[model samples]
Target: MGRGGVPRPTGRGVGVLAAGVLVVLVGWLLQAPALVFAGTTLVVLIVAVTISLLFRTADVRVTRRFTPDRGVAGWSAVETVAVLPRGGRTSGTVRVREQLPFGRLSDAEAAAVLLVPGRASSAVFRHHDLPRGRHRIGPLHVDLVESYGVARRRVVASGVAEFVVVPEVVEVGLGRESRALGDGSRRQREHSLAGGEDDPVTREYRRGDPMRRVHWKATARHGELMVRQEEQHGLPSARVVIAVAAEGWPDARPTLPPTSRVGVRAATAAIPLVSDAFEWAVSFAATVAVEVGHAGSATVLTTPGGTLVARHDPDSTTMFLDDLADLRLDDAPGAPAPAPSPREPVVAVVSGLGRPDLDLLVASRAPGSSAVAVVVTAALPLGAGLTSRPTRPADGRARADDRVLAPDEVAGALRDSGWRVVETDSSVDVGRLITTSGVLDD
Candidate 1:
């Protein structure tokens, strides 16, 4: 390795150099003119090839460009690598190998390229079926090969790029069914505040404040600009609770019998049930958070470790999603935290209604608080080929057979406790499920 680049001798180049030395020694001992000439010519050719490859990769530059710098799960992103040689003309083939996201680059097409000086040579890496997480596509390895493929030089690209694979989000509307029962009473108070001129709430004028809201008497009394603060009336307030406890998640086991391969038993494969369930639950939580933001509700996102106040803005949404991107299932459930304000509706995403989870939901529920529990059970071993078809029990009854299905049991418990429950599997459309459940609509 040198300051410019690392030079590695190819198999053919090493063989040629060894043969040239052996032939030269033999010719010197035998005093043969023709053999000496042949030996010297071979050595010169090898030296020339090494020298050419050494400098070709020294000044080479590589830049990567991602078609939509960010991607989502199950979506395709294209990465284009641009190769340029700074000074001299590149004599041989330039291989641009890229580091791909989510192990998405299994094909050999990401490396095939020829470098043209003064003109950029580009190679495309198509990343498909990306998972929801942060992926780094960077530190390109560029290999410069001689025309005869004898000598090579390696150069690592300077920059490393990052791509965020966010969870899929669907816009959900807050339906009346999703609203808290206290919402009506709160609105009644807001209306009273709006009609009463003597209401005490007042604030300094803001940029978007209407002139009509300016109180001349208050302004004169305060000796500065003042405006009567209007009551909060944009949308019904809602809170989102996300529970990613490992305790509530079911362990994945092999669903099928082991088969023999070459007369030997193969290891049983298990579906990533717990991982899948957690991912689905996170995505569902993110969708609900977005809906709450859109409704202009006071958003409260509760995780196992802590709570985050999410506002209706791009930065807040990005920050929340970024947290979800790195979120994982905790080994044990955290201690009980402060619950959301009882005056607004609440949406909770739990693996299932285990004792702790049920207690938390019950504690958060007020007498008139409208609450929705989204139970994510796609990973549970309920049955074969389960779909997301929500069923209502007759006379608020739970079937005896549903005891095995923990999600169903949780749903029944919630329903009987006077809370709306939405059951979801991996195949369910989160956005559609929320909207169809009438949680986001009036």
Candidate 2:
């Protein structure tokens, strides 16, 4: 529950009621006639106690049901509240406040409603797009008031779960070809088959093969053991890795030098970009993964949509999106050694285009896995494709003067290491590039 939420009233409810009861009882007993005051006091005390006993409940359980469960960063996720009163039922005023995900701010649609005995009323809340990351909902506030608003009782609701606000997932074609050259092919060559992915052929079943796949017709015709053969599928059509090298990113000291501004801005914009980028990437990844099924890859084993992480897995997609939503400038993954594996696809999205360390990282990975570096600096060149976004700075050093790499340079470097580099024009919408690539648009 949020701050200023209604708190449960204890002494206020019984305290005022008891005091009035005592005063009346004494006045009746001490009066000369006695009967007049005594009769009135008895009636008042009985009524007060009766109402108190009726509303008294020790255990209250609060739960919420959310619709759709996941949505793009800009959309809303509606939820309903279920209130279960355990000890006893009461007819009185009930106030509730629900905590929203992340920095998401919320306003109540309806307020100050009465909760009748043994009945539960539902309320809906719309979550706005806050800064991206893994947002969680929790901390319900239950406030109970009695004795004509003289007092109130409050309790806290715990154990709320988290939801990820990812960039909208969109499709990016050719990403499979992009990734096939990296994470997938390496795993296949080491563990599965060794051939161009597009080749149309099937492999015989092995120890793990299911009886359902056994080719009875083939066995009958061949007079020997035979099983279904599966076709080979190509590499991932897309691979999206949002890399935030804190050291290579911005420290954001306004007093700092000109170069610092680039890092700060790029890093600061991570959630905004990541939120949208991953959302788009997931769909792109999944669409391509579907074809891999024909290629004999088990979901997760050989494809992004499969065992590794595919479109069919909402939970996995949610996880990837959430990680991006929560991303911030963390120190470089401890002075980046060789990546965990040669097949890992690393996409360096940074603010400073002139970072040499980042360039070295990309250059190093070119030999083992394809690498892509996206620079988002204002001083960097602009226009569509690399061929347009570069020029020599006043400093005039080819590699050092402030200049965004031309597409040719990027593509050349990536190709040299057997990777591919694609960039966006500053004039173009970054979101569009992400979406056209088949990532989320939201």
Stretch of 10 with least lDDT, candidate 1: 252-261
lDDT by candidate, in order shown = 0.63, 0.43
RMSD of 2: 12.5
Q: By lDDT, who's the top model here?
A: 1
Q: What's the CA error at residue 105 for candidate 2, in Å? A: 5.2
The lDDT, on a scale of 0 to 1, for candidate 2 is 0.43
**TM match of model 2 to true structure:** 0.48
Which ten residues in a row are the worst by lDDT in model 2? 301-310
Q: lDDT (0-100) at residue 227 of candidate 1?
A: 70
